[model samples]
Target chain A: MSMVEKKLSTKTQVILTLLFILGMALLLWWADKGFDSYKQRVLRLIGIYAIMAVSLNLINGITGIFSLGHAGFILIGAYTAAILTLTPSEKAMSYLFGIQPWIKNLHADFFTATLAGGFMAALAAFLIGWPVLRLTGDYLAIASLGFAEIVRIWANNALTITNGPLGLKAIPEYSNIWWVYGWLLFTVVFIASLVYSSYGRALKAIRESRIAAESMGINVFKHQLMSFVVGAFFAGISGSLYAHWLTTVDPRITTMGPMLTFYVLIMIVLGGLGSITGSLIGAAIFAILFEWLRDLEQPFNFFGITVPGIPGIRILVISALFIAVMIFWQRGIMGREELTWNNLYKWLFARRKEGEKS
Target chain B: MNQEVFFLQNFFNALMLGGLYALIAVGYTMVYGILRLINFAHGDIMMMGVYFAFYTAVLFSSPPLIAAIVAVAGAAGLGFLIDRIAYKPLRNAPRISALITAIGMSFFLESFAVVVFGAVQKPFVQIFKTKESKVILNKVLMVGGARIPLLTFLVILLTLAIFAVLFLIVYKSKIGMAMRAISMDIPTTALMGINVDGVIGFTFALGSALAAASGIMWAMRYPNVYPYMGFMPGMKAFIAAVVGGIGSIPGAVVGGLLLGFIEIFTVSYFPTMSGYRDAFSFIILILILMFKPSGILGKKAIEKV
Candidate 1:
């Protein structure tokens, strides 16, 4: 508690922090220029997907709740961004009643559109979460899923905002590597800090045992709701990123029911639950695997013989892989352990240890 | 000679729709009654049943009775096997685990079917397509002159038959007593030397059979059969199960009938509000959970913590 000791500790901490930042900056700077446009696209996609996976971790991993409604938040975010950023020409033509005069031509930039989408999604989540979050376990899951369906239906019918089922197309592609990674870095640091703080500890406590947490002076509903809202906010941001990246937004694009959510869940589960590192690695692997498998959708030749129906073959193979992963690697690759320096070292040194043992 | 007939017709249409819903609702109710988990894949199972019926009909090509029997049996077998292999082992895991598994199985089945059946919509031709018949009522019943199809009457008859069979099995038979005993307290029934697994398996079989039958009936009404057809009805049936007291047999029937009417009336009265068809049921569910978690006619059980 002495002033001199505190000052020394602060200086040491600052030195370590500077070194860490410098290291990361050097790595990103090096990777940025070397990465081609396509590689940059992949990185941006990873960043957006990482945001989604991390936000979902709040619900499924941290909270021990299975929610199939993450896509619902994404849908809200997409539509919100579309409405906010589209030009007056688009607004005037799309709107049968015509756009509001003041905000008609109001086209916000990428960040503002993303923020608008996130906040709007957060607002929607707050409204829906209040009642539905009360139910626990499967009841909560089904109720949330139903709520997502309702949001989709509302989006489909609300032509004034969403352009009905035809969907909003011709969105600007503004989600580059920098913006995507910027948001990802913000979310990662924010959530990681939150998890390490007292509030994060309390959230973990609530997840461990709601009744016990309630008895121990934690407000279960409030904490759960907060997590839901924050998680949904990040999901919304990811949604906006997706919209900008694909240059299109459609209610129908996100209307595949639990399929997208299921894939995301599988990624997190396969990576390892309750681990941010797992989610990041899992999302990257998933995106790459998906892209690789997409090639199977085309006709190919094996030793000069032509193959037929490659897309159909790919679905069966992927589904089978999903089932195998579920049955065999239940704890996933990371097994709830973070990819911290020590863990990574241990993983890398596994061969040495095995040799010593031999 | 008035609009009264149309009202009667719509009313009858609603009733028939309710009957079909009740058929699927029973499966959801029974499974939930025993397991206390929503089988997210139940709808996809019903999809399998429809496909089974379709293929069986194609195979027999004569005697609708034989084809129906074969399809129902095939569906029942598939349901039984799915329960034995996928669900029974995971009975003791966290409800979420089972739920995820259900979702996985649903994906597996739907994708598998899609691979085999293709993604195109196929029309389901009834073994015997009946022409519309006029129902003569003493009073002039009409809802803007919507005609009451005689097939609606057949559905009513089928619904009555299903209820009668379910009632006799659940209340009047020894196996029914065992089922009720297990539902009330599985351990106690097991302690009393009743085979719990057998009863559970039988429950699944019964429910799956009902689902298969309902799938056929639904295909009859809707006529189009696709790999993903069971999803909407499955969801509505789950909602109905929740609305009607989940574990209560009679509740499923009532819930189905109520949901059918709600969908019909909502579509008929306010076509613009038709998009809210599914939303209304979910809202009802939320309200029911908030106000009365046990649902209509469901008995509340206090947990002894």
Candidate 2:
């Protein structure tokens, strides 16, 4: 609490943040040089998911808004990016039903397309949030889920623009470790800063007591809508990253049937609902586990015994893990605590000091 | 088919669909009424019921009525087990945690079904395939010079009978009184010497039994049993519960019937919009939440804050 200690702490934080950035850059370089195609793909996915999980945490965890329409925003971003980035000839080949004449000749570079995609998603979020954000709690969850379903149905039937489930193929592969990690870094810093700001305090106030927050002159609806739109914007960016990385986009990917939103939900819940550090760790754990669990679906031999592959066993295991986490570790791994140097120091060495003080 | 016949046939189909939805919606309403948690796995329980009936009839060569009974009983057991294992421990936790657990339970049951019963669709055995049963199901009646299948009448009658029985049990029986008391306040109910947990278990069991019946009836009409079969209907039924005012049994039935009519009429009148039929219920859900969050039959609870 002394001035000298405060200055020392700030200095340590700056040094630690710089070191972390350097470490990440080194990892990206090493990955570019050393990792196999599969490892690189997984690493890229971790970055994309980190962005997604953190953004979702901003809305669901920090703001206490139970919005489940993430897939709708992601779909808009994916389709926008895919449509814009596709070469005119590629568009012709993919749009079997027929391409719209106005957008037929349009094309953009990867960066421009991705930004446009994010903008479109944010715009959509703002419009939808105006009406949907009026609801609360479980009603909000179901209504948002319905909105996602409606988006999927629209994508499935809109032949001229979306190709009506035929889906776009051969999108240029423009996402890599640098792109994903860069976005991940931006998302974490931006959201963390936002969380630490006055607006972020207002959101937490609304979460804890809406009536009290309103009495304090906080515009609950406007703040909730802002958090939703911002979260949706990042989700859009992540979707663009995902689409460009895979080189394909489809309506099925955005539908609730595929369970993509559930996976994101599991990550946030597992990582710690309201912690940025938890979202990062949760995203990493989920991406790795998802890839590793494929072994459960593939036939493997153990001690000269042939075990038959069970195709759906992986999902079953994951679902069981989710239920177990909810039941036993309801606060999740982070429990509203962030992984900072000061906290780490306290956990390691300051316990004795605290005990003596007490 | 002539225009009149087409209209009549679709109208009858809507009635049957409504009956099926009502059956499932009642289960959702009952469970939500007691627990204040949406049992997401309710749909998968219906799927389990369909599979249970199919396996019992095929494996044991049991009579159709016996298979139906076994299926309903099995579904009730599963629901009871799910409540005990999943929802019971979280009774005092935040409602959001319980909701998340419900979603996880839903995912677990669905994926478990896929693993146990393969992902492929199986042709459901027609209970009415026998000559004697067909005579009853195939018996048609002329209404305004249009022939209506007797099976449609059977489904509607079955749904009504079940609802009537459920109504009597809930209104006239002591157990139903316990259920109502628990829904109002679990602690008070427990303090008053009513076994709150037992009533909740009974409510879950009853809901599961109804879901089973709806699943079997659905398979009888459509004749396709798959692991994911219950999802769409289950979601529609939940929407019905919400539309009808979530905790009210009568509201659920009305919502289900209204939804069925909307779905069927959308398809019949606007053929091109058939693919968008599923979206209609969700649109209605949003509208209902916007204008009447308490639903048609639900009593609104004032927020404490």
TM-score of each: 0.89, 0.96
Among incorrect, acceptable, medium and high, the docking class of model 2 is high
| Alpha-carbon RMSD to native, per candidate | 5.1, 2.3
Q: Could you tell me how far off, in angstroms, the CA of residue B285 lies in candidate 2 after the best superposition?
A: 0.4
Would you give me the overall lDDT of model 2?
Answer: 0.88
Tens digit of lDDT per residue, candidate 2, span A1-358? Answer: 2223312378888899899899989979998889999999999989988888998899999999988888888888888988998888888888889989988898999888888888998998998897789898888988888888888888889899999877788888889889889889889999999999999999999988888999999999999999999999999999899898878777873242337778888999999998999999999999999889888788988789988888888789999999999999988899788998877875676444334432
Q: B1-305 in candidate 1: lDDT tens per residue?
A: 44575456668888988888888888888888888767777788788888887876665554455666776787788778878877777777666667777777777788778878877888777454333211211123333565555456666788799889999999999988998898888889999999888888888888888888888878877888887788778888888888888899899989999988988888877888987776788777778777777779788867443
lDDT of 1 by residue, A26-52 (tens): 766777889887776777787788898
Model 2, range B226-269, lDDT digits (tens) per residue? 88888789889999999999999899999999999889988998
Interface RMSD, model 2, angstroms? 0.7
Fnat of each candidate: 0.44, 0.72
Stretch of 10 with least lDDT, candidate 1 chain A: A1-10
